[model samples]
Target: MGKVTGFLEHQRVKETYQPAEARLRHYQEFVSTLPVLDARTQAARCMDCGIPFCNNGCPVNNIIPDFNDLVYRDDWKSAIDVLHSTNNFPEFTGRICPAPCEAACTLNFNNEPVGIKSIERSIIDRAWEEGWVVPQPPAVNTGRRVAVIGSGPAGLAAAQQLARAGHDVTVFEKNDRVGGLLRYGIPDFKLEKTSIDRRVRQMEQEGVTFRTGVLVGDWPVGSRVGNLSTETVSPERLRTEFDAVLLAGGAEQPRDLPVPGRELDGVHFAMEFLPQQNRVNAGDRLERQIHAAGKHVIVIGGGDTGSDCMGTSHRHGAASVTQFELLPQPPEQEHKPLSWPYWPQKLRTSSSHEEGGAREFAIGTKEFIGENGRVTGIRTVRLAWEGGRMTEVEGSEQVLPADLVLLAMGFVSPVGSVLEAFGVARDPRGNAQASTEEEGGYVTNVPGVFAAGDMRRGQSLVVWAIREGRQAARAVDEFLMGQSALPR
Candidate 1:
């Protein structure tokens, strides 16, 4: 512990967000990392608890306390090393992750938790500025080639690790651009594209090759999943060439609302609306786009995707925006006694929520109302929950006016085209069936084929994706060389 009484002496400080009015004018990151002095002060607040739960709380198991102590002692170089030992991309997690680690901090049992995310962001930023981040190519090539599908965080992490372990690595991206979901699914307002580009550059120097505009298997025709492939590669080709193949593609099949007027012109999936703006921001000239400008927008499913829709609608100068959630609202404050050192269900207000929007809870969309082959409004009903079962409240049905509707419900599973092409078995939830056991883990039914990230475990966080990617790299390395020194 840097300061034994630090928790009692200091207060938790958060990263600063640009004013909502100014931030809404453009599609760029609005949050500013904490200053070095404030970051050190925040780091001093880590407790000398017997066990550090923040490590287990994080999906990648980041060394939270060690880095916290390093930042407090002004040893930034050591902090970055500790951070990179476990996590490959601190920048991504620092900017977008919900930071479950903070929720599990010992100080959070009573006092505000240390600003671990902000400190993490500061450490990496300083490392990049000082040019400490560099490529570490393998000393000797093993002549073993590994093919990675998808250029998202998981694929990138696995590719980088395999390259460092002396395997010839190549990543195939279906879209015209790399970064997968980070390039298209997430908006630039939360994370600028340059953040991903620099990391890609570093990975390239580490001997990992990226081939964009290439699809590995068939994509469902007219599917809402983003696709900009200029070429398609058969699964047989990869098996014949590469020693191992890792499926790291995302779970992109967005959950749909199959109501009466679902086919209306103005209704669309959240992926359909979010990706266009990202492409436009990247300077691509789209012939047509799903714009929210000058329209009344209704976003169904009150999760992160719904919040993103609301934010983008604000940027588009929509007339009004409303969000709906089927479940009841969670309490603003969590009960520490019951949820200590664990992720608790509570209301989380994002930066977009601060900009503007109406949030409706315990409400379900019954039908889509439209005229002239376009959406005009939505029919909704309030509900009550008893004994964990929901019952619709009588006489509480109403219509909410809208010009556009976006289904922002979470993803159900990975798009199955690639799995089908490779003849891989799927779990009950439609994700690739692969265990996480110590032996023969991350391997599919097909020899030399492995699965990880959302493709294997279904939709999850970026940190989880990185963890799976790293572990899968180790699994592939062992399969290729009979053993590996890479961390699992």
Candidate 2:
């Protein structure tokens, strides 16, 4: 602990952001960093708890208390080293992760967590500026080859770990660029593509080969999600060419709102709309692009993706924005005494929500109203939950004007064709079937093939994906060499 009474001496300080009006004008990161002095002061607030719940709260089990002490002691280099010890991408998580670690903070009993996320973001940003982060190429090659499918967080984390362990690692991405969802699905404002590009460069220098626009399994010809690859590499080729294969392809199957008029032209999946803006920002030319300009937009779903859609639409000059949630709105604050050491149920108002929008909870869409094949409005009904079941309320029918509708419902599973091509069995929920147990962790039914991340664990946070990737890398290394030095 930095100071025995630091928690009482200091209060949590949050990262600041540009004014909503100014940030809405461009798709660039607007969150400002805390000054070095303030960061240290905040870090000093970490308590000397006998059992640090923050460590357990983090998916990758980041050594939170140690790093906090390091930062508070002005040991900048060591602070970053401690931060990087567990998390492969603190910058990514710092900006986008919900910071479950803070929720699990020992101080959260009173609802004021240690501002761990802000400190994490500060450490990484300063580390980059100070030139501390660099490639760590292995001293000797193990002569083992590994192929990682999907370039998302999980795949990237696995490939980086495997390469550092002296294995030849190659990552295959269907998109034209690296950084899976980091590259395209997330808006540039939250996480810039340059961050990913810089990391890719470092990975390349560390001997990780990336092959973009190369599909590793059977994707139906001409079928496209956010983006598609023209070239296809069969699963057999990968299984034969590489000693081991790890599938980290994320769940891409979006759940559809199957109400009436679902086939209208203006209705689109959130992925479809999110990636186009990213592509356009990257200087790629799309003959046609989805726009919210001068349109009243309705985003269905109340999760992070829906918030993203809300932000993007505002950037596109949408006339109005509204978000709908099927479940009732949670309380404004969590019952801290009962939920001190876990993620609590409560209302979450994102920065995007503060920008501008209306949010309706306990509501369900009844139908899409369209005019000449284009969505014009949405009909909805109020819902009441009784004994864990939702039932429609009488005399609650309503219709709202909607020039554009984006379905932000979460994904269900990985694409069936991709899994089928590898002949990897899937769990009942449609994720690649695999266990996280020590004896046979991440191993698919097929020999020499493993699965991790959303492909195996279903849709989850980026932090969880990194954890899965790191663990899976150890599993693969052990399977190939009978023992491994890689961290789980």
lDDT values for all models: 0.92, 0.92
The C-alpha stretches of model 2 lying farther than 4 A from their native spots are 219-229, 438-440
Q: In candidate 2, what are the lDDT values of residues 371-426, reduced to their tens digit?
A: 99999999999999988999999999999999999999899999888889989998
Which sections of candidate 1 miss by over 4 Å? 218-229
Span of 10 residues, lowest total lDDT, candidate 2 = 221-230
**Alpha carbon deviation, residue 105, candidate 2 (Å):** 0.2
- lDDT (10s digit) by residue, model 1, range 327-400: 99999999998998899999989888999989999998889999999999999999998899999999999999
Q: Give me candidate 1's TM-score against the actual structure.
A: 0.98
- Quote the lDDT for 334 in model 1: 92
RMSD of each: 1.6, 1.2
| Per-model TM against the reference | 0.98, 0.98
| Residue-level lDDT for 124 in candidate 1 | 95
